[model samples]
Target: SAVISQKPSRDICQRGTSLTIQCQVDSQVTMMFWYRQQPGQSLTLIATANQGSEATYESGFVIDKFPISRPNLTFSTLTVSNMSPEDSSIYLCSVARTRGEGFSTEAFFGQGTRLTVV
Candidate 1:
């Protein structure tokens, strides 16, 4: 299993601003994923970042707004751009660790960053 450490656990930003969240894994990981969780809502996958490659953003997400950077196997960053009240949410970083047979893996998550855009 990997231990993920995320920074700026919570913050309140002004409208039209941006926040950059960083994630660091104790061990190397093949893939890293970023997610957003609105109040009383389930997790929404924002993007998947792989080391040495461009991150793939999910539908309703765009790089221009949610840019991601994975510089190496154990580090990645997610930036929420042009913030607004509607963007208030908790952002999380996660990585999956597979063991033994088929598609069986345990995912580890960081202590999410709660952003309140006003």
Candidate 2:
């Protein structure tokens, strides 16, 4: 199991400003994922970050709007660019680890960064 930590657990920002959220894992992971959970909505994957490669953004998410960096196996960051009121949401960091043979890996999530854009 991996323990994840996210910085700036909550914040209130004015519209048009950006916020950079950091994620740190206690153990090294091959793949790290970023997700967004809007108020009253289920989590939506934003991107996948692989060390030494450009992060892969999900549909409806563009690199310009949400840039991700996976500098190493245990650290990654996601920056929400050009913030808008619609961008207010909880951002989460996730990692999946193998459980056992014939069983699927379980995902571990950080507490999440709650952002509110005015």
Candidate 3:
């Protein structure tokens, strides 16, 4: 199991400003993922960050809008650029670890960063 921590649990920002959320893991992980949960909506995967390579973003998300950085195995950051009211949502950091051979992995999530744009 891995322990995850996220900073700035909540924030209120004016429209057009950007916010960067940080994710830290207690143990090294091969892959780290970022997600967004809009109000009243299910979690939507934003991107996957792999150390030493460029982050792979999901459909409907662009690198310019949601830039991700995975500097190492245990640390990553996601920056929401050019904020808008539509961007207000809970941003989550997640990592998965395999339970055992032939078994599915268990995902661990950080206490999400809630952002509100006004």
TM-score, one value per model: 0.97, 0.97, 0.97
Report how far residue 38 has shifted in candidate 2, in Å.
Answer: 0.4
Off by over 4 Å in 2: none
**What tens-digit string does per-residue lDDT give for candidate 1 at 16-69?**
999999999999988999999999999999999989989998999999999999
In order, what lDDT does every prediction score? 0.95, 0.96, 0.96
- Using TM-score as the yardstick, the better of models 1 and 2 is 2
Any runs in candidate 1 off by more than 4 Å, and if so which?
Answer: none
Roughly what TM-score does model 3 have, to 2 decimal places?
Answer: 0.97
The reply for model 3, stretches above 4 Å from the true place, is: none
The lowest-lDDT stretch of 10 consecutive residues in candidate 3 is 97-106
The full ranking of all candidates by lDDT, starting with the best, is 3, 2, 1
Candidate 2 per-residue lDDT over residues 1-118, each given as its tens digit: 8999999899999988899999999999999999999999999999999999999889999999999989999999999999999999999999998877877889999999999999
| Candidate 3 Cα RMSD after full superposition onto the native fold (Å) | 0.7
Per-residue lDDT of 4-70 in model 3, one digit per residue for the tens? 9998899999998899999999999999999999999999999999999999999999999999999
